[model samples]
Target: MNKILVVDNNPVIRKMLSSALEKEKYQVECAEDGLSAFDCLDRFVPDIIFLDLIMPNINGEQFCQMISGRKGLEHTKIVVISGVAVEAGGECEMKGVHASIAKGPQFVSHVIDIARKFTCDHFHHAGIYQVFGAENLFPREISKELLAANRHLKVVLNNMSEGIVELAVDHRIIFANPAAAQLAGMAQEKLLASDFAQFFSGNDQIRVIDLLKQNKIMAQQITDNDPVMFNHQQVAINFLPVHDRENSTVVVIIKDISKTKIAEERLRETKEYLHSIFNSVQAGIIVIDVETNIIIDANLRALELYGIAKPDMLTHDCRDLLCPRPEERSCPVLQEGKTTHLTTQTVKKRNGQTMHILKTATVCMINNRQYIIESFLDITEQKKLENKLHSLSITDELTGLLNRRGFMMMAKKQLRIADRNPGKLFLLFADVDNLKWVNDTYGHDIGDMLLVKVAKLLASFRRSDIIARLGGDEFAVLLSDSSPTGGEEKISARFESLLYEENEKKDLGFPIEVSFGVVAYDNYKPCEIDELIVKADKLMYSSKKSKKI
Candidate 1:
């Protein structure tokens, strides 16, 4: 019969181990700690010593070392029995230790198997050591708790997504979970028979070997981008090194990061496509982080528009780029919770030149983060063209003065201001005298020349004055604020002096004359521009009749 000495701090565990060993018809003795076991060993030498790592006096490590050095006990086998066997596998595998069994549901059975292996005939019975009537063997309460804990632990390990593997000191896999078997593309038996490091290839194998040789816990064995592969799947490896030199082992944890890696790769590809579109599109594009309101990215067109480099533009506040005034810094879409915004606005460039653009801002989500995409279409030239077209619409083609439509528009505005502010506003209307006779006598060219000359004389008024040719040899002027008091005398004298100078030039064959009407607007009562024109016209015809008399 094999003589086995069970040593542990827990009385129940020691009793349990001894009871199971004795059930196999072996001579078994129990000790509460390493000290008691050694005292028992002084007279009774066990063929195999079941040891516990943590004890009150003389721990298992010291007992193993002392027994390993002691004479007449060279052939005795040492088996470590401890709750921390998996965590301290290398520590438990001392010089004398033949095996290490974790204190679990299988612990008592492992003790029986080791005892039978050393003492019984080889190949006697290789199966789980089933203690018949286990209820009778252990106290009912403790037995239920232990069985429940073991069953729970087994369930958790078997169902875990991370591959759990425990290796022997010789690099043989001693245990493997279903996840490990799945990751290795093999059965649990095949995984147990194979070397764990053989699953890795090239530098990955080198990294695993280094982790084992270092004998330290490493959270990750390789870089994130370049993870270890098994069965054509990306996996991250974690190593928990056993601390004992004689019983050195490694526990590997394999996690499937294939989904995470694939997601990252897809994100990268999407960014590449966005980058391509950003530069290729004619519009300037900028990406902003909604949380920070910062410009996180800018395309080539945006960089060119800003006259800045991409690196310089990045990390700048979006408001700094888009808004020149502090009051305009608030984003309409972001602050108002709107989906998008569009506007025709002006932005200043690095060169301090103002640029007109049709800008669009949109809220977008990318990879679960909120962002604003601002697109700018340069409309500076387009704006210039629009203004030029507008000018042509309301401008007199012949005299470069406000046309009839433009005159009415501006005159109405000034009348409203004068009405509210109670200011002096002068309206002057003039008709070319003898213009028809000049056209009939000296030809229409000279008559046109005379009309142009009169238009020039009217322009001599202050720029604030509104001047217009109201069709045919007729012209009108709106003289405001800048006109001195007694404006009618000033107007008559100014035109008389201009006419005298033009007739003296002798380029014109005929003398230039004009009948003028000056009317003071009623500031208390506003009137339409056409009404003002009618009053001014009646006065002008009266002046013409007095001139004829």
Candidate 2:
């Protein structure tokens, strides 16, 4: 049976047309509006469409043009139905409309005759005009104003810069405006004659065909976010479905976005280029938004230094991550109006451990927004080395005791303590009596061993005593809270016995001897450390002379 689609907003006209067509055994579908008619075409491809010129959403003239624009449905016949012939006369004469039916008392017969003529159905009713009150349906004369208005609409479409094309269900172009022709890189006449999909090859053609099917079947609009190459020019395409009661049409809007696409590609490449450079540097770099105090970006080194991932490193507050102290919260570069700063700072890592860093922070403007760029190197190891070197400066390399400089500094501190409290402090100075004689007879190495033995013997004193190798063959000790003059004599005798025992061991292959002097400091009569050292030296030499005797 021939399929007939009746498109009209009026229910009565739809009923009248459907009844007439169905009586002749033709399959009939009814739609109230152009959109509903398009939905109806999803299931039924009608052989003929009974279109009304006046309807909601898409009027009859638009419906006729859309139907004729479809690829496979070009052969489908359209007959316009009009209640007031002159009012819709210009639209009724649209290009795709094959015939016109004037609505009147003879509407039924006029509808039947037109269906019969188009379908060429074998079942024909004799005197169908008289049987259903049929009459000849002829095209009415249109007003000059309506014709001029139609011409104006065509003129506007031709003048638009955006390419406009109407495609059929089969992805074929049925109508294209002048801009569309130019976008396709072909003359308007040739573009209309050629296939639409033929303009794009390979995957682009496949994608466009799939898009058209979706648009037509779904009766919705689809737009491309990325531009596709059309005729060697980048263009953005939009597929909008325009449906008639019988067939589906998709309006494709093409915009030339080649320059925009190029600009976007260049911008993407520039960002990648800058990112590579940012990550390749040796220093850890972090960019912070000065206003928000948020870490806006960090490079690879920065991420590694903080023991954090890039995503977690960003958006962190500077005060929380780098500066934990309230006093250190103020940024020097930002508040002090300094363009740059070089300072040492402690950074807290993700694991809660702190690292010492030599950081250089600079203030800069990016896109008119203030930001701080912080570049730093980890100096925790360097700081440790410096502390070690400082310790070594105040210590004797061989004896592991405080040197002359270290002894003077400690002895002065002790006298200062003695002044605060009444205490008997003793400064003992000793000399290696035979160090030079041993050096002459058994080489300097043995002499050095003898001197070391004396140092060890002296170190045997109480832990509270400060033992120092003042220089070669010379040593000093500061004893705090010692006894009276009798107690000092006993302490000196105890040290002399320790040396006598070392000589019996023959540890250095020779005997060890030393001369010593003890000078007492009265807390009530505060004396300078230099004067104490001089007094001890004189007494030490007198003791050395007695050792020879």
Candidate 3:
């Protein structure tokens, strides 16, 4: 096995070169810097030294200069490796080195050829081997070891993810790897010996060829974020200028960056989608620093909420805006650093007018900093609508009285309040006499008028009383207070007086008569509202039966 030395500052590049050389059964040693390579040189005399031009401590030019004056190592060959084009034509032009190969796609094959020239027995300068037919690039034997080694080189190029192509000094691609053919979306044979300019699309071909014409290194453009397209496929390309002291072989590396470009586009699109949603939302969203409690970012709705734009909003303290009444107000969400959802609060606007708002806030960690994501909705109009809906849900539309549901809800609440004071709660169930007969003879309009009249009579019954129309021709009344106990008698007397007054004012076909039933709630011994209602209903039915007889 031939002993090869690889000296490069980059560990990854050194490892890659060492692995390729070792695969060809060469004993490879590596050094990180020029100083380290010098130390390795004193101990191990390699057959071919693949020297890097630019490195820390002692560079390739310095290393070559130092070694030229020394003795006994005259048989050892130096193949200078220059990553830059200038270094190959300038530094690697030193008389001591046998050849110079640029660091690029053809790097591995160059190392193998150089190693074979010094070690292999059946190497002919002409019949030895030819790569791209540009110059002598391979060493060969008639059979066996050389044939397998040649196959191994082909396999390595075939398996590489990046496309590697050997171009002549005219920029015509003489050799194309399987990866290069795949990237170009064509067969390898179809691309071989084709002009390199034809593979690239758009203005990239001009810029690329111009740089190549100038014999410049593509390393600077390779490190750039922008990539070019080849055969409609996105590709990052690099050119390596390989000088053999006589002629130059320019190798092109094409790396497919389509997936990476697509990912970047998707991420940008996702960011735009999120931004649209944030601004379009009805809720005013504001992001504030948790430590300083200052407004950092806000959406359009948030700006509208405060009547201010960005820089102005940034000046305002978020806590001060929310808790303007410092003496009387404090935010629990801010203090506790926890989520508060749909909390109803009255906020004073910039104009000093108070508006009701439903605010929600949560603590969030953004970029390793604590922030509060606060969202709020102006619910002043909503509150007004909600109160109206609440009233409609409970009260009857026609008579302006509590419906059955409304009566029960308030009755329950009032009963609880009265129970605390331990006052007697009286329930009165009232029904109009001959209401069915009135509807049958006088029609519904007259029947409705009669119902309304009775409802008006009971409208001013008592302040503490909860009065409601339980159903058709039936009503419920709850009276519970500390002051008076003759509530039932008062209702009876008022009903009779209204009945007489109506009869006197108009000549009616029949008289309006009302029947009443009363029950007293035992607060000391509590019971449900249903029991009191059932008891009152039974009493009302009994009174009706007595009057009928």
Cα RMSD (angstroms) for every candidate in the order listed:
12.2, 11.7, 16.2
Best by TM-score: 2
Q: Model 1, which residues run further than 4 Å from truth? A: 1-156, 166-174, 195-220, 240-248, 274-350, 355-382, 421-424, 432-451, 480-486, 508-516, 523-526, 538-549
TM-scores, in order shown? 0.60, 0.61, 0.48
Give the runs in model 3 whose Cα sits over 4 Å from its true position: 1-274, 305-313, 323-331, 334-359, 377-393, 422-424, 481-487, 498-510, 542-549
Worst 10 residues of 2 by lDDT: 125-134
Return the lDDT, model 2, position 375.
Answer: 95
Q: Is candidate 2 or 3 superior in lDDT?
A: 2
Model 1, span 204-246: residue lDDT tens? 7787777776654533365566787767788887777765633
The local lDDT score (0 to 100) that residue 371 gets in candidate 3 is 80
Backbone steric clashes in candidate 3, count: 0
Candidate 2 residue-wise lDDT at 274: 94
lDDT, each prediction: 0.77, 0.77, 0.75
- lDDT against true structure, model 3: 0.75
Mind giving the per-residue lDDT tens digits that candidate 2 earns over 1-549?
Answer: 998899998888888778878889999999986656765777889888888776654567655655566666766777777765644444456676666767767777878876776667422333122112224544345544565686798899999999998765556565678999888877554554246788888888887777776775554433436566789888788777777675667788888888777888899999999999999997899999999999999999989988999888789888777663746878656766789988898767889888999998999999999999999999988988987887688788888888888888888898898899866888888988877789899998888777777788889988888889999888998886445457568768888888788888977766677889888887788899889888989999999898778
